[model samples]
Target: MRKHLSRVLLVLTIGMCCSISCKKDTLNINYGAITEDLSAYLYAYTSGMISKASPIQIRFAQSVVEEAKIGSVATNVIRFSPSINGEAVWEDTQTLRFNPSDYLKSKTTYIGTLNLAENFFQYP
Candidate 1:
C-alpha cells in the first residue's frame, strides 16, 4: 500500500509538471512592427499582363518616404526615369501608388529600384 501511494504521487507530480511546462501558448504577431535585428528593404511589385496604355501601379511592403525616387532599367541596359509626375500615396501605412505621366512600353522588361532616404530606416 505504501509503495502504491508513492507511485501515484510521483505520477501526479509529473502530470502536474507537464501540464504547467508543456502546454502550448499562442503567439500574437504584429505584422506592422519591425523588430530589432531585421534588415528593412523595399519590395517592388508587379501585376501580370498590365495594360501598356494605362497607368502603372507599384506597391511596396513597407511605408516609404513620399519623395522616393523611382528608377527603372529596360532590357537595353539603359536606366531612365520611368516614374514621371508620380505621387507616392500611402494607401495604407505599407503601400505606395505611383502614377506616371505616360504609359509603359509594351512587352518590355523593366527592373525597378526604389531610392529610400536614409532616415526612412532609422529607428528612434
Candidate 2:
C-alpha cells in the first residue's frame, strides 16, 4: 500500500494542486498551512492512485464546500468528469476521502476527467 501510495502523487506541495496528471488510468488535494505531517500523512494515506483500490484523500485548511457533491456519483457537485463512483467517507472533519467501488480491473482502462482535465499518473 505504501509503495502504491508513493506512486500516486505526481506533484507534492503544501498549497495548490500543482498539476493534475492526465491519463487513461484510475482516479484520485488541498488547503491550509499544511504541515509536514499532513503531506506525509497524505502520501501514506494516498492522495491518489491508479489501477488500485486505495482511497484518495484531500485535506483542507477550512472545510470543503459541497461535501455532499464530493464522493457521490449521483449528487456530486465537485464535477469529476466520467464521474467516479465511490463512497464519500471522511477521515476527519477536514479530510475527505474517496474510495472507488472497484478500481482495479485487469483489462478495463478507466478514463476519468476532472472539469475537462485528465490525469496521466500511474503505478504497477
Candidate 3:
C-alpha cells in the first residue's frame, strides 16, 4: 500500500510539471524612429590694422538650431569694422564661404554671423 501511494504522488508531480511546461508565454514589442535638429555658429579674433591686403579667417563654434525647414541650409555671414581706436568703425557683409581665408581686411575688428534656416523638421 505504501509503494502504491508513493507511485501515485510521483505521477501527480510529473503531470503538474508537464502542464506548466505546455503553457505558452506572451510577449509585446514596439519600435519607432527619432531625429534631431542641426545648427551652426561663428568665431574670430582681433588683429591691428593691415598695411597691405591680409587674409583673416573667422572661427566657428558648435551650435544647434531646431525646427529647420526641409530645403533651407545654414550659412555663415561675416561682417567687418575697420577703426583704429576700436570706435566708429564701418560694417559690411562679406560673401558666404566655407573657409574664412577667402576674405581680406584692412585695420578692423571682424564679426561673424551664421545665417541658418529650418528645413523639414519642426521644433516641438
Best by TM-score: 1
Q: Write the per-residue lDDT of candidate 2 for residues 22-119, one digit (tens) a residue.
A: 45533223322334544543333233323355555555444433445343332331223344567555555446566667654433333332211211
Error of 1 at 43 (Å): 6.3
The model with the greater TM-score, 1 or 3, is 1
Show where candidate 2 strays beyond 4 Å: 1-51, 64-77, 104-124
Model 1 regions lying over 4 Å from their true place: 1-44, 53-58, 62-85
lDDT by residue (24-104, candidate 3, tens digit) is 432221211111211122232222332223333322232223323222323322233221111111121211222233333
Which clashing pairs does model 2 show? 21-119, 21-120, 22-118, 22-119, 22-120, 23-119, 23-120, 69-77
Q: Clash pairs of candidate 3?
A: 43-59, 49-107, 68-118, 68-119, 69-118, 69-119, 69-120, 70-119, 70-120
Candidate 1 all-Cα RMSD = 23.4
**lDDT at position 43, candidate 2:** 31
Single out the weakest 10-residue window by summed lDDT for candidate 3: 31-40
Error of 3 at 33 (Å): 43
- Of the candidates shown, which would achieve the greatest lDDT relative to the real structure? 2
Tell me the whole-model lDDT of each prediction, alpha carbons only: 0.34, 0.38, 0.25
Error of 1 at 12 (Å): 58
